[model samples]
Target: MADLPDNASQRRARAFLPALEDREFLRRDELRGLRFAMEYHKADLLLREWGVRSTIVVFGSARIPAPEAVEEMLAAASPGAARAKAERRARLAVWYERARAFARLASVRGGALTQRPDRIRDNVIATGGGPGIMEAANRGAADVGAPSIGFNIGLPHEQEPNPWSTPSLTFSFHYFAMRKMHLAMRANALVVFPGGFGTLDELFEILTLQQTGKAPTMPVVLFGRDYWQRVVRFEALVEEGMIDEGDLSLFDLVDTPEEGWESIRRRGLHAHTPLAEAPDATPRAVDAES
Candidate 1:
């Protein structure tokens, strides 16, 4: 190699490496489309490989803590206003357990624990992969020893994915659109808890899809009736002709986790797993392919 001449001919003869191997080129601004494609395919391919054909998409507040964490905040507060705020959060904190319980119920009944003869899993819990409600949902799936997904996103502030989701199915995305797509792609039903701007964004995305007939009419449940009613005057949209009166039926309001799951069941979320079938039945009915 030392004997090689340092000349124009030698430089040209080197034969530059393929662009596919060029990490720097891939990171360039012009390759943004490729980056987006990569984000989508990574999650999509992995979800398929894991046999996840459908999911129960859960969306909720990241600020809200588990019940015990809120209790700790209550204990640490110095006085009046701080203590009052902590107490309020303590009330909302119950949602953490509710989300967890709901996820467990879905996973146990929704074929996530049992791969059918065709090897497809449905109603596998999928969350934003952050803490609070996301963590609670993922944790619930873990509780029942079922697989779950955590579609994490890159945020300006350092956000971490919860540990409860299956490692093979956990993913991180640089694009919110790609992350949202993954969340909505295979969603069999949606369960939303009390949350702020980000949660609202996701909720409306699916609502718009269903409203425009872009997505299937899946059951949607909005947990915490009081919070949702106080926060969103959905009736105003109907009265003002911004939306149809029936558009409000896109989601059901419920106060408890049991009520939330019941609404979905009533709305036609079929439990394809053996657990839901008749005990004395002979041959099981084949689960409909997704």
Candidate 2:
């Protein structure tokens, strides 16, 4: 093993002795302690390296359960071993459908959700580092050879840093609040995709921020027109008079990548660099209490 740094606690048994710097033989336990501290501090450094600007946070379902085995067998195979064959076919079809759904979600008119300089230049893509839609967006950016970032979390399920991410940019967080912080910090725009509870959580957080003027200049774009319209009834809020008609204008519903790009660009709202560190990179999650 390489020799520990002179300041390493193990090497500097005097680390705890009032003096902060030391240059001596490192103790095993002290070395471990120093290493842990270094590892913990690396989170921010990694995030900074990832270039956290111009991000579009995309979320979507991972489990699009395949069709029933019997249905597949009936569609393809006949009697005897037909059931097994049919089931396999059905599963394959569902997988194909799931892949297609992700492909459409990843496709932004310009190209696949691979990394690209345009995302960095346009301030357009970022996400909660994982598979599904997040992977698609990062992949799309990578497709064009641009560094993409992912705020990956240590989750029991539904989380992993996608392969497309710029190596140093992948961040794993112990705190959900911290992970969410990185998501909204330098975000020039928020591009929401169809997802379950996590998607709803992120959507509301952004809405709350814009509605409260906390992230006033930031604009939100919702992808998947049909899904969004059916999922939430913003019109009801407007009609109820709880919010003004103008309030609904904070976010624009978009069906295509071109339209989504145009809306933000037309207004000049997403001009800021998405990765530049913000003065207020730390904000309480956007909710009534926050």
Error of 1 at 39 (Å): 1.0
Each prediction's TM-score versus the true structure: 0.88, 0.61
Candidate-wise lDDT, in order: 0.85, 0.58
Determine the backbone clash count of candidate 2: 27
Which candidate number has the best lDDT? 1
Model 2: worst 10 consecutive residues (lDDT sum):
281-290
lDDT of 2 by residue, 146-211 (tens): 445667878776476767666666777766776777678766667776667888998888888888
Clash totals, every prediction: 0, 27
lDDT of 1 by residue, 32-98 (tens): 9999999988888888888889999999998778877876788898799988887877788789989
lDDT of 2: 0.58
